[model samples]
Target: MAVVNKNQLLDFLENRVEGHLQEAIRVFQNERAEILLQPAPDGGWSIAQCLEHLNGYGKFYLPQINKGLNQANRSSNSEIFKGSWLGTYFTRMMEPTTGTKKYKAFKNHIPAPDLDAPAVVAEFIHQQEELIVYLKQARQENVDAIKIPLSISKWVKLKLGDVFQFLIAHNERHLLQAKRNLKNLEVADKS
Candidate 1:
């Protein structure tokens, strides 16, 4: 992973969180349930499923990130963030524009087809708000020194900065997919 000024990275992540929040509020919130529940033309997950999938991840990661942030010691000096090789790999894999590869979600994270669209959108909005708070708190701590355990395995931990990068990238990927679903729905409706 590339080394970067900690503050710059956090700011970037915070911007992404804000974008996600706005997307939820401005786009998803106003969408009707039928549209949110409609799958893509290629039979992919619906918009509600996409948000619910992210919500599932937030359920596991938010508390862990908060715990890590609370336990982290304050840094008296500015620091640089350098991600581990595994962390870099994960973050890159999750990036929306990286590749066309389709990764399967863990069974637990796979959302049900019949989700309540309004509730899922509301939860996603709330999670993005919480992420903004975490990003702010992270500025006071040594992001490189704190480690957050992966949801996949407790033995595997990532630097706090890496966790933020990976989680935000994952969110971006799914949010892009959800937007694609919306576009497809619109095209179908016009036809």
Candidate 2:
């Protein structure tokens, strides 16, 4: 990850996350519930499932980030965040440019077939707003030093900077997936 001032990082993250929220809202306004829930022809997830999956991750990460920020010492604040090697690798893996290396959702993150599309969309928007708050809080602390546990394994931890980067990148990945699912639905409808 490139070294940037805290404000720049916050702006970049907020723009990326908010773009996802806005795109989802736009889809909700134009699309019916059935359309959002329609599975891809490839047997992949639907838009609602994609949003719910992101919500599952937010449910774990948002609170953990808040708790970590609350308990962390405030003696130091670095203007530039030097991301961890492991965190950077993980974040990069989640990027859409990394090709289609899919990972399993660990059961709990998987949304049911009967998921409510509107509710899932609302939850994702709420979570993105919460992430913005956490980013603000992070600006006041030594984000590079604070550690947040990975959802895959509690034993594995990452720097706060890396965690934010990974989460944002992951959000972008799934939001793109949701958009693609919607497009697939459109194409299938034509046939």
Candidate 3:
């Protein structure tokens, strides 16, 4: 098990989690439904779709995380968090890197093109807030020992720490995609 500074990890996750929250709010304030629903010039997912997809993931993971946190054995806070090798590997795989490979969403996670833009955005914002709560709860739990089953396959499980890392990275990846989609829409409008 690889050890990490628990305080540092918490701070990192908190900063990124709040960033997503603020980003979602900014998107809600600045973009209208038409702009959010506009598809990429090349027929990729629209900004609304990107967020809806994330919401789908959140719908599955958030509850499981909450349940895990609730059931986790009460223990004194550790100064360091020990990460499982498999979980760490999965998190690293999902994280965004320069020239990262694109992954297709599983069928159930795909959002319909006609999804309500405002609702999708609002759901994402709500989910991020819920995730922030879990991050705080995690400070008191043995995150490395609590296992969360994967939504994609029930048999596959990951440590809570890895789950947080993976989900946050995944959200950031799509948020960046949504921003790019909006930028492309702007360029098209000006053309």
Candidate 4:
């Protein structure tokens, strides 16, 4: 993927975060957990599980974004610097010097079979709200300056701003999975 432009990212969020926030809330307002958790035919995650799994990164990104904002500036090449685990993995796999490589994908589900859908949706909403607050509070200068490890996995380091970008992209990727899960739910209903 192309390196995200700092000013462009700031501008993009400034213009779009509110919309994304609202859109997310609207979609989530009516989720049914049982329907969501049912497995898909391709053996992928249920909607409930995917949402929970996607938020897994907030444990790392939320704190890292704060650190990037508080730390000193290293604006030059911040985005380009090798990422911790996720970033490094992405960089090496998607190297400009190398031919295209498949984007590796994975998923997990926290055990909570009894948890209701709204509760899980509530947690996701909480995460999105936290992200909105963080992104809104961040400065363009900080966006260009800070780089944090993408994971303890040392996949790679990422620009603090890119943290949000990855978050949005990652969420959408799973949301698509959830939508697919819905289709599977439909197919099962027919069967």
Candidate 5:
């Protein structure tokens, strides 16, 4: 996969991710619980649940990614020299859901809450806000240098930018899940 410039991608996220996120939130606000928890016949997620998961991991990685970005070239000891537990928890939880033993994008895994979105995403967002406080310090060249040995693959090092891309993709994946769920809801209603 082509690695986009961190600053460029960050700008893209400011508009694109935010817009999609706002729309998804609107869907959540309008959704009923019956539709949110269950998957459609086609195996898709409801809008509310998707928001929970999208924010779930973003909330986790934003802080770590920010830490790595902010500390670029300044100190040998970046806060994320070792990543946070949130990322680790996220992976373990998501394991049963996605059915993969290991992650390809991140050396350390980030998990999804096995139970629900609200609890996980709330934590995710709080840290994200903290990370955002110093986002200006983030730069592409610097972030690219950030690396960590893979927990699943000791030989591999996961780059910081790839983790960022994964977060964006993860959001989109859940957003699509929500859309598909919406369609499923419509079909169920029709039936």
Candidate 6:
């Protein structure tokens, strides 16, 4: 992982979360339930399912992040953030870009076919709001010193900064997937 200014990293993440929140409010929230529920042309998850899968991750991560933040006592004068190799690898894999390989969602994280679209969207918005607040709080502590446990294993942990990076990247990946699903549905409707 590359070394970066801690504040700069947090600021960048905060902006991303803000963008996601705005998109949810401006776009996803206004989408009809049927449209949101409509599955992708490839038979993948629907838009609502994508959001719900993200929500499942948020439920696991947000509380863990809060706990880590509260327990952290180390304060660093230097703003530099050095992510662990593992952290970097995880964040990079989760980032959504053209040609990123698809991965199956964990069985626990997979969302049900039947979901209340409005409520799912609302929950996602709320989680993003909470994430923004956590990012702000992280500035007061040494991100490298605080370790948050992974959802998959309690024994394995990542630095606070890495957790933020990974979680945000995961969110971005799923949000893009949801938008793609919506676009495919629209195209299908026209056809």
lDDT of 5 by residue, 148-175 (tens): 4433454655566445444555555556
Tens-digit lDDT string for candidate 1 (46-148): 9999999999989989999999988777754356888889998999899977845999889889899999999999999999999999999999888888889
Runs of candidate 6 with Cα error greater than 4 angstroms are: 74-78
What is residue 134's positional error in candidate 3, in angstroms? Answer: 0.8
Per-residue C-alpha lDDT of model 2 across residues 64-153, encoded as one tens digit per residue: 999999988898878888777798899888988873698887877888878888788888888888888888888889888889999989
- Give the C-alpha miss distance for residue 78 in model 1, angstroms: 4.3
Better model by lDDT: candidate 2 vs candidate 6 = 6
Which residue ranges in model 1 land beyond 4 Å of their true spot? 75-78
Instruction: Provide TM-scores for the models.
Output: 0.96, 0.92, 0.94, 0.69, 0.58, 0.96
Worst 10 residues of 1 by lDDT: 70-79
Model 6 lowest lDDT segment of ten: 71-80
Mark the regions of model 3 whose C-alpha exceeds 4 Å error after superposition.
none
lDDT of 6 by residue, 54-94 (tens): 99999999999999888888555348799999889889889
Total clashes for model 5: 5
Higher-TM-score candidate of 4 and 6? 6
lDDT tens digits by residue: candidate 3, 1-191: 67898778877998999999998898663579999999888899999999999999999999999999999888744667877787777677777773288777889998899988988898899999999999998988888788999988899999888899889988988999998998888898899
User: Clash number for model 4?
Assistant: 15
User: lDDT ranking from best to worst?
Assistant: 6, 1, 3, 2, 4, 5
Top of the candidates by lDDT: 6
Off by over 4 Å in 2: 1-3
lDDT of each: 0.92, 0.84, 0.87, 0.60, 0.50, 0.92
Error of 2 at 117 (Å): 1.4
Clashing pairs in 5: 59-124, 90-110, 90-111, 91-110, 91-111
